[model samples]
Target chain A: MKLGRHAFGDDEALMMAIVNRTPDSFFDKGATWAEDAAFARVAEVVAQGAEIVDIGGIKAAPGVEISAAEEKARVVDFVARVRDSYPGLVISVDTWRAEVGAAVCAAGADVLNDAWGGADPELVDVAAEYDAAIICTHTGGVTPRTRPYRIDYDDVVAAAIADTVAYASRALSAGVARESIVIDPAHDFGKNTFHSLEITRRLDEMVATGWPVLVSLSNKDFVGETLGREVGDRLLGTLAATSVCALAGARIYRVHQVPETRQTVDMVWSIAGRRPPLRAIRGLQ
Target chain B: MKALVPGTLALLPSYASIEDPVAPLRAACLDAVGRLGPRVRIVSSAATGGSGARVGAALVAAGGGTVVESGETGVLVVGNGSATRTEKAPGHLDERAAAFDEALRASFAGVDLELAEELWADAACLRDLPPLADAEVLYDDAPYGVQYWVAVWA
Candidate 1:
């Protein structure tokens, strides 16, 4: 997949490495929380096989609370540094605020990965204003960590599918091209494991919606339960899960272990093959 | 599929209490993976934590994983559909119940180990795990374990 027509193309699956610059983030602890370390990791991921890098200032993750201004600052510092580190790299800022989105785009972010399904209209405005490619997420039936209510859904796949389509429609209306828009069926965002497994098992169906997809299933508990391993020992599980995502039709993968996941994608692509099917049905009769 | 270190599996009673390791660990484990990057897969730390050396020893005994206390979130923040939920028990039962029962019942040869508790939602509150301060557990009978899904075709 080539982002923004700069001749930047991923030969196989494009791995989007995460560079979160936040204090309360569950992962990273203190490792790569620093600007220099974040910058270095970005380079390493690219060198390892990441086609793109996603840097977020504030943790947009569930149960996290951040004011817009603070979000902007968090994104600005690391994104700015990373942007400077690699002029040719495809950098993205994971923010839903239009202001922060705009600031990051101006600061050198190439894409906007919004987890809010564009619920923040300003985010769409920012994408349009900045002329940056956007990744519109559909967090169907997600259970917000901070909110006081519990989330319940009867048809998770259907709901998520609808959410993405609806959100994409909004993005299209906002001037995001069909090709430039990518959809993510937010796993763990709200759905339970049953729903998550159902979605994953039926991944091809999710891909059929006529848009590129961004999958973030790294080191997550889903893979952990499968292997009965601990959170710290999820490397191989992360790789396998990423492989499944790639095999299922994910164009972009947001990951923690960049090099290894990239390599895994390459290996699977060779074995699984991403060849477009023969078009006998469309051939001149 | 090795679990992501510090990754959360399901919201178990062990980690469920507002003040317990289950709730907080869920957040912390997610962060660990977020920090560890995508290569590390996560498992349910609700049972993995609070067990202290037992959890670490189990992980070490299982031979190829690390263990830690999960915080308030998960790396994937999945819908619990992607994971394997166990019967509701405090963060103490996951692996213990299985082997505990397995050892006692394997001798019977025909008997299957009974699950300690049915997995549940926040609303179930079957066990005596503390509640999340002002928070409610929502669907009490929600099965344990949920997965954070990847992108798929529509």
Candidate 2:
């Protein structure tokens, strides 16, 4: 699979570390809102061995509206700065606006992480124009930044597969490279706790779709509710969910705790026979 | 020509890890096997289906050498000293492991098979072999609390 300038082999798994530029994000609220602080976060994740850094200017939940101009102001220059600093890092701008996507791509962003599914139809066009990668997420047709209030699906897994695959097709038709397109089952976007659990259980079906699957299960609401833990305390639960997805062949992990999540995925990946152990001796010795 | 390598299964390609646990040992084995020319015979304690011959075969193949049933070019012996070097070792700590390996380091011609078996030593194959007095010792340490050696006699 290809992520912008980097091409990965089939057996590889990637960690896309979340570097928030928003002050109102539920997790790490305002910690990295300052540009310098965000840059420092990028440095930390890079040191922790993350292959990609996903920068988002706005929070996912409903809040004061952020215009395309404001989103561009938040991420465009920052993307350029990160690009100048880390030449090998895969820089992804998380926005649903085609305008902001285009601006960030021009400023050196490699991926457009449209976490709200395909709310903005022109987002794919922006990706195609810049030769950037796109993340086709399954948000169940919800408007951007809106919470899933009593959202129900007969089979959440099937809906995710249908929606993300269709979105991927749309991106492919829009002239995006097939290898650069990725599918994400956006957990808890339009999913209740039960729905999120089922999607996690059946994530292998999404992998079977033959697109590189990206899972954004990083400290999300599903883990919080499932284990009766609040935002700051959900890392263990998040890693538990991550193990399930990693074993089922999810190629990319959008994560908050880079080192911990990487360890979990590497361990599970080895257990699934996709990766070799780091060093093994015991009985063989 | 004759060479000796540890019978550790980790030397086999099928048991390999991303970070090789036996890299130095493997290098020594391959260098010795390569010097043995194109065809070599294997001497190992493990039965036909066991990992001893498999490890020897893999090293031989990697070194561009083939195994021969008769009229062999060289001999590849697979054996090790003891698995009870330390408390954390596979057989736990045995007080006699260090001295037993020391004796084999001096000479392998007169090893007591019953004592070797009791200590979990795979040196039964090395018992009838010539002394190591003239052999070049390539490797002689136990990184994982198990004794291993890679030596060659030319």
Candidate 3:
């Protein structure tokens, strides 16, 4: 798959580490809200072997409304600093606004991770203009930043496939490179616990759509509600969901913990016969 | 010409690892096998299509040679010493394994079949061959708690 200037093999599973620039993001809770702290977080994830860093200025949940100018202020310069320092890493900006998308792309972002599914129709055009990759997610027609009050689907996996595939085709029609387009079943975005769980169980259908599948199951509310755990305690549940997706052939993982998720994916990849053991001579010898 | 190599399953390509655990042994085995001429005959107690015979065939093919039943240019012997050299060995440490292997290393003739079987050694087909002192010993070590030797006689 091509993420702007970077091209990766089809068999490789990538870890996209989360670098929050928001002061009220759910998981980090303003830990990396300061620009310097966010830069340090980028350095840490890079040292831990992450291939991509997803920088998000606005929190996903409903909170203080951030304008496009304010969102650009939070992420544009920071994206430039990260771009200048780490040329080999893929920079993905998580926003649904075309204005923020264009600004971050000018500052050297490689991917636009539209977590709210295509709320802005012009975001794909901006991706095409900058020659950047776009992540097309399934949000069940929910508006940007709105919670799923009583969302129901005839079949959650089918709905995810239909919506994400339509978005991917729209991106392709807008002149985005076919290889640069990816589909994601956005966990907990327009999904409750049951919807998210069904999506996880049937992720292979999304994988079978022939566009590379990306899963954002990184300590989300679905995991917390499933295991009766708080946000900080949802890592194990997240990893369990990650294993299911990995076995179903999810290509990219947007995660908060780089090393732990990488280990989980590598282990599951080997189990699925997509990877070989590092050095195996136990019974053969 | 003739060559001898341990019939460890690790030598097969199907059992290979990314970082080969038997790299040194594999190199020595390939070097010895390459000198055994074009058409070779494999001698092993393993079933005709078994893993040991497969390793022998792979080595012959890798050396740009073929295995034939008749009119062979050289003989390739597939067998190994005791597998009970240490506590973690497949046979789990037989007290008499070391002495039996030491004696067999000096000469392949007059092997005690009963003791060889007890020690989990594949020595039945190792009989009537020239002693190790008469060949070029490319490798002689017991890695992975299993004794292995790569030797060539010209």
Candidate 4:
């Protein structure tokens, strides 16, 4: 997959670390709200071998409205600074606003991670204009920052596949490079706990669609509901889900913990015969 | 012309790791195999399973050589020393392993077959080959607690 300045092999599994710029983001909760703190987070994940840094200006959950101006203010300069500092790092901005997407792209962002499932129709145009990658996601037609209350589907996996594929088609029609487009089943955005779990179980169907799958199964509500663990205690559950996705051939992982997720995916990738052991001399000596 | 290489299963592609543990050994084996010309015969130590034959074929194929049944241009022999060389070796440190390897290294033509079998040494094919006193030794070491040698005689 090509992310603007970088191209990854088909056999590679990439780690996209979450770097939230929001003061009230659920996981970090004002930890990286300061620009310096967020920059430090970028450096830390980079050092931890993350290939991508997903910088988000607004929290996923509902809160006081953040205008596009505020979102651009939060991420544009930070993305520029990170771009200048780490030219090899894939910079992705997690926003649903075309204005924010274009602004960040101008500031050297490589990917527009539309976590709200293409809420802004022009986001794809912005991606094509800037020659940036776009993550087409399935959010069940819900508005941005809204929780999934009373959201039901005949088959959640089918809905996710249909929506994400349609969104991918839209991105393709908008002239987004085929290699730069990625599909995501936006877990917990328009999905309840059970829907997210079902999506995880049937993730291979999404993978079978032939669009590279990006899974944001980080410290989300689904893992919390499954293990009854709070936000800070969901690393193990997230990695377990990540292993399932990796086995099913998810290409990109949007994660909070890079090292743990990388180990899990590498282990599963090797088991699936897609990757070789790093240094295997145990019995073949 | 003829060459000898270790019967290391790690040389096979199926047993390959991302970081090859036997890179230098592989390089030596390939270099020796390349010198065996285009049409060569493989004289592997093991009569059953064909492990040595597989390694020979792979190395020959990689060196742009073909295996021929008769009228061969060169010979590729596959054999190795004892697996019980060190305390952490695969055979768990047999006391006679070092001396057995030393004897075979000096000359494999007159090895004691019963003692070689007891030490888990793969030298049956090497026993029939001539001495390596005048041959060019490409590699000689035991990186993985098991001794390996790559040599060529033109």
Candidate 5:
């Protein structure tokens, strides 16, 4: 399952755990971002089968400052602490800032997971400069409180791929190669729950884009809305969403509860990959 | 009043430059369960094969989940992709319908398909047009017949 600069074996769907150092992140508030919390959580989630640890500072929930320099400084300490603490781990720095990306790269971060489809075009340079793998996720406007679930595109999957391709083209123009990048359909970023469901439903189609797929639907608000529950209560919904992601050919899953999501991904992957390759298609349906 | 069949869910319609009927399937499934009960699950199951029998055979080889019918709240949403051709008979669908139908299952999302949502919950699920009989025959060609993965339940 190795995608770009990162590596995830096919033993199961890759389990990338969330280690939010920020106080306002939707889940795991101040739990793992603290220096002490980092040490404990790294061991816990890694031991629980998290091959990748995504550490981030600040919360991108709605209405937060979307400033670049602020994002960089917040995670500088995060990257330094995690990279130093987990010498052998694959650390993914989650941000949409080139400066933050450059800083994390300076601190030994192995990958960059951008919520925007390389939201910062300059991120391509940072990724290339740092020799790190970059996962270009789908991005749309944020309404922190609500996740819209409707059809902006008659086919969300196609739009996702086209947007990703355009982003990839931009990254390529910026000197990032195909092997250095990955793509996500921007699930829940600009979508409501139903739209998120549609993204999940049509994921395999996105994989057809050929970039490795990194799915980060861990306990997101869409799951919260779909299950008619809150973040903590949406574990089952999260598991189901992960299962669907795995089955839909997502190579990576960004989740808060690594152990459980990893187990679920393994089960679904074990069942899905043994057969023929996933049928590939185009456009949105 | 449209149905999305399975192979259609594979982005075939997208490849063919068609609109996937997933939203319509969502609409149809909601309508079916709303008009009936709320236990039915809408699963956009995807599979590949040439005909219903062929795809159904592969689905069996690949393994099948539940048999969907119009009982209380059991029906498979004919799957994804854009509208291709139009036909007006039961089982008059393109090749993808059978393949999608074979692989459909329940959503583990914990969604009570039998229930409705506050938003976009008023969508309808029509098995066939006035001229078409079975959902299978009319896989494509409806005014809003975007394909989806087949939906199934107990």
Candidate 6:
């Protein structure tokens, strides 16, 4: 798969570390809200062997409304700084606004991770304009930043597959390179715990669609709710969910912890026979 | 021409890891096997289709040679020393393993088959080969608690 200037083999599973620039983001909770703190996060994730750094301005939860200009202000310069320092890392700006997407792309972002599932229709056009990869997500047609209330689906996996595929087709029609488009089942974006759980269980169906699948299961509400744990204590639960998605052949993982997720994915990848052991001489020798 | 390579299954491609644990030994074995003619006969005590025989076939194929039952130009012997050289060895530590291997290093004849079997040494097919003193000893070590040697007599 190609992410702007970077190309990877089909069998590779990538770790996209989450770097929040929002003061009120759910997980970090303003820990990296300052520009320098956010920059430090980029460096940390790069050092931890992350293939991509996904920077986000506004919190996914509904709170203070951030303007497109504010979003651009939060991430565009930060994206340029990360790009200049780490030329090999894939920079992904998590935004659904076409304006924010275009600005970050100009600042050398390789991917536009629209966590809201194409709330802004022109996001894909901006991605095509910059020749950047776009993440098409399934959100059950809910409005951006709103939690799912009484959201019902006959088959959550089927709905996710259909919606994400259609969005991917839309991105393709907008001149985005076929290999540069990725589909995601945006866990907990417009999904409750059950919907997210079902999506994780049937992720192979989405993988079978031939588009590389990206999973954003990083300490989300679904895992916390499933395990009856708070956000800060949900890492083990998140990793368990990550293993399920990885075994189903998810190509990209948007994660909060890079090293743990990388180990989990690599172990699952080897178990699935997509990768060989590092130095296996136990009994063969 | 004659070559000797250990019957470790790690030499087979199917048992390979991303970072090879038997790289030096594999290189030595392949280099020795390549000096043999296009068709070579394999002499091994391992049962047919066993890991030892498979490793021998793979090395021969990798060296641009084929295994043949008749009309062979050279012979390839698959055997190894004791597998109980250390506490972590497959058969665990054996007090007599090092002395037995040292004796075989001096010459291949007069091997005690019962003692070799007790120590988990695959030396049954090694009895007829010339001593290491008369051949080019490419490798001789026990890296993973299992003694192995790669030698060629031309």
The TM-score values for the models, in the order shown, are 0.59, 0.97, 0.95, 0.98, 0.58, 0.98
* Model 1 per-residue lDDT tens digits across residues B26-120: 44333333343323222232432333233323323234334334532222111121122343333322544344333322222222213322321
The residue-by-residue lDDT of candidate 4 on A139-254, one tens digit each, is 99999998888999999999899998999999989999999999999889888999999999999999999999999999898999999999899999999999999999999999
Candidate 5: stretches off by over 4 Å: A1-12, A63-69, A141-151, A275-285, B1-154
Deviation in Å, model 2, residue B146 alpha carbon: 2.7
Residue clash pairs of candidate 3: none
Worst 10 residues of 4 chain B by lDDT: B44-53
lDDT of 5 by residue, A1-285 (tens): 443345554444567788876767777766665567766887898788787888777576664664667667667776787777777788888877788888888988888888766556688888777767778766553343334445376666767788777777777677765566778776788766777898898888887777778888887888888878986888999889888878878887888887788678767875774332233232222
How well is each residue in A1-285 modelled by candidate 2, as lDDT tens digits?
777788889998999999999998999988999999999999999999999999999999999999888888899999999999999999998999999999999999999999999999999999999999999999999999999988898899999999999999999999999999999999999989999999999999999999999999988999999999999999999999999999899999999999999999999998998888889887888
CAPRI band of model 3?
medium
- Tens-place lDDT per residue, model 5, B1-154, is 2323343333222222123334453344333333323332333332232322222222322222333333424333333332321242122345553332222222222322232111111112322212222322322333323333333222
Chain A TM per prediction: 0.87, 0.99, 0.99, 0.99, 0.86, 0.99
Note the Cα lDDT for every prediction shown. Answer: 0.56, 0.91, 0.93, 0.91, 0.59, 0.92
Error of 1 at A114 (Å): 0.8
DockQ of 6: 0.86
The CAPRI category of model 6 is high
List model 2 lDDT by residue over B1-154, tens digit each: 9999887888888788999988898888888888887899999986324678888999888888899987898999998888789998888889999999899988898897777877788877998777778888898898777889888898
TM-score of 4: 0.98
Worst 10 residues of 1 chain A by lDDT: A276-285
**Candidate 6 structure quality by residue, lDDT tens digits, A1-285:** 999889999999999999999999998999999999988888899899999999999988899999988888899999999999999999999999999999999999999999889899999999999999999999999988888999989998999999999999999999999999999999987788999999999999999999999999999989999999998999999999999999999999999999999999999999999999898888776
Cα shift from native, residue A232, model 4 (Å): 1.5
Which CAPRI quality tier does the interface of model 1 achieve?
A: incorrect
Looking at candidate 6 chain B, the ten consecutive residues that score lowest on lDDT are B46-55
Once fitted onto the true fold, the runs of candidate 1 whose alpha carbons sit more than 4 angstroms away are: A5-11, A60-64, A141-150, A275-285, B1-154
lDDT of 5 at B76: 34
Q: Which ten residues in a row have the lowest lDDT in candidate 3 chain B?
A: B44-53
User: Where is the poorest 10-residue window by lDDT in model 2 chain A?
Assistant: A1-10
**Per-residue lDDT tens digits of candidate 1, residues A22-85?**
6655557546767777777787887876768888776545645678788887678677777777
